[model samples]
Target: MAQEMTPTQLQAWRALYRADTLLFTHIENTLRARLKMSYFEHEVLRILDAAGGRLRMAPLAEQLMISRSGATRLVGKLEEKDGYVARRNTPEDRRATWAELTDDGRKALKEAQPVVEAVVATFFADHVSNEDLRAASRILDVLADANPNDDGFDCGL
Candidate 1:
């Protein structure tokens, strides 16, 4: 049996959608102005930083929830901006190229960390009570656990 959501539930869902959009937009703008990094660029840099400063192209694409072509384009842009570099991993697989974080990329991420943390704390964390945050985390964990391909999702959020 399925029950229809009430108007209040519908409204809440809509609010959640709007909140997600606004929060992401705010963060994007902040990062761009403060660090000269777009949201996607920041995400790529973050992933590289987490992967010990390097990641295979295929895995990076999967982690970023983007196509291989899309990842290549993003990597090209990052390389042009001197944030990172792509190199052929001939020993592992001659056909595949890996993206490695440059020293400048690490410096950039470190510089942006404070601003990013402040924005996150101010906009997202400050509004929620401690108990509510804990509950939301638990719910999110449950949802993530139910997904079989959790690693295929973007790491930005």
Candidate 2:
């Protein structure tokens, strides 16, 4: 049988897992009830926004830890809502498609930014000190490096 985790390991794992779960639920619910956007949606917008308002479908999927088809489906839904997004073929690579954030999408993202910031500050950041955040980030990086195949990094979002 495999050995059990040490107390330090367990604490770190539980703290990160619990915090992520609770934060995701709280942020997603707040967006859904107040802004009619899912937390995933906000994340996509933020990513695209950070990437100069455009990112290819595959990279976006990889960043979000979802499948290609799932990304397409989610983008399709958002596309219908007043042209929030536009999909285009990458001329150099027909197989690669791009999702460009439209003006409406940017507007929506701008509006949602404060809501997200506030919720995050209230639920996550407020409880942690600056030094702890730095240490947590480093610990997470170490953890992520140990599990490279997982492709989920705290630094990504």
Candidate 3:
């Protein structure tokens, strides 16, 4: 059975939720306004770039913390509309597909990198001390370890 959260715990949860939502919204809005890129799209490109400009579709979805189909749609848009990504099928496995970052994607990421860095620093890093950030990082590690799966959380919302 699930244990009921104490008042303090509930308050902490609420605070965390509000902070996450607000921060996310702020970053999302800023990225959209300045670069015309959604956070997820930017993340996809970033992840692909980090993976040496190419990754299998499943792992890409996993790293993005989204469903495979969601990754597919995003990749499709990046491929067709933006020409930022390309898909290639593996010879060993006909079903396996790789998402590769295009030259345009690299240029876009180069452009958006500063925007993301500045926004994160101004909106988040400025407010939190190094000590606070370290403590938060430890706490977040615990919370993340409690649920180690890579699957998305569905609250039926």
Candidate 4:
């Protein structure tokens, strides 16, 4: 038989879940209103921006903890809406394509930065001490490392 959590443990789990949900909700709303971008969309752009402004589809999918198809779909949506990303066949591997962030994508990211930064600071930083933040980061990093997939959830579709 599996051991049951105590009431305190259950409460702690619930609190953490609620906190995470609220944090994401807050960020999502802010991003949608200010930048017309979903959280996932923002994340995609941010990752591309950080990766010297381009990345192969497979590597980008891995880095984003998403499947290739999922990344392709997301990239397609971004391409349709903003024309900020393009897919090109890799010269080294004709079978593979690269997702490159366009100049417009860089500009969109730059425009969104201020709003995202303020939201992050207000919702996360203002509430947590530096030590608490560092400890939380360490804990999450450990949890991620222990998981079979670097992503916490199975990308079942």
Per-residue lDDT of candidate 2, residues 31-124 (tens digit): 9988899987887888899999999998888777777788888788878774778998967999888999999999989989999998999999
Write down the TM-score of every candidate.
Answer: 0.82, 0.87, 0.93, 0.88
Better of 1 and 4 by TM-score: 4
Query: Compared with the true structure, what per-residue lDDT tens digits does model 4 show for residues 48-141?
Result: 9999988888788777787888889989888888888888886678998888899999998888878878888888889999999999899878
Those runs of model 2 whose alpha carbons end farther than 4 Å from true positions after fitting are 149-157
Off by over 4 Å in 1: 1-9, 144-157
Evaluated at residue 116, the lDDT of candidate 2 is: 93
Model 3 lDDT tens row, 1-157: 9999999999999998998888878889988999889988999999999999999998888777677888899999999999999999988998999999999999999999998898888878899999999999999899978976455642221
Candidate 3 to truth, TM: 0.93
User: RMSD to native for every prediction?
Assistant: 3.4, 3.3, 2.0, 2.2
Q: What is the per-residue lDDT of model 1 for residues 1-157, given as tens digits with 9 covering 90 to 100?
A: 8899999988977887887788888888999998788777877889999998898998888877777788888888888866465545777678878899888888888887787788888889999999999998897678557974544554332
User: In candidate 3, which residue ranges exceed 4 Å CA deviation?
Assistant: 150-157
Q: Report the CA-based lDDT of candidate 1 relative to the real structure.
A: 0.81
Q: What are the lDDT scores of the predictions, listed in order?
A: 0.81, 0.85, 0.89, 0.84
Q: Tell me the deviation in Å of residue 36 in model 2.
A: 0.4
Query: RMSD in angstroms, candidate 1?
Result: 3.4
- C-alpha RMSD between model 4 and the true structure: 2.2
- Cα lDDT for residue 13, candidate 3: 95
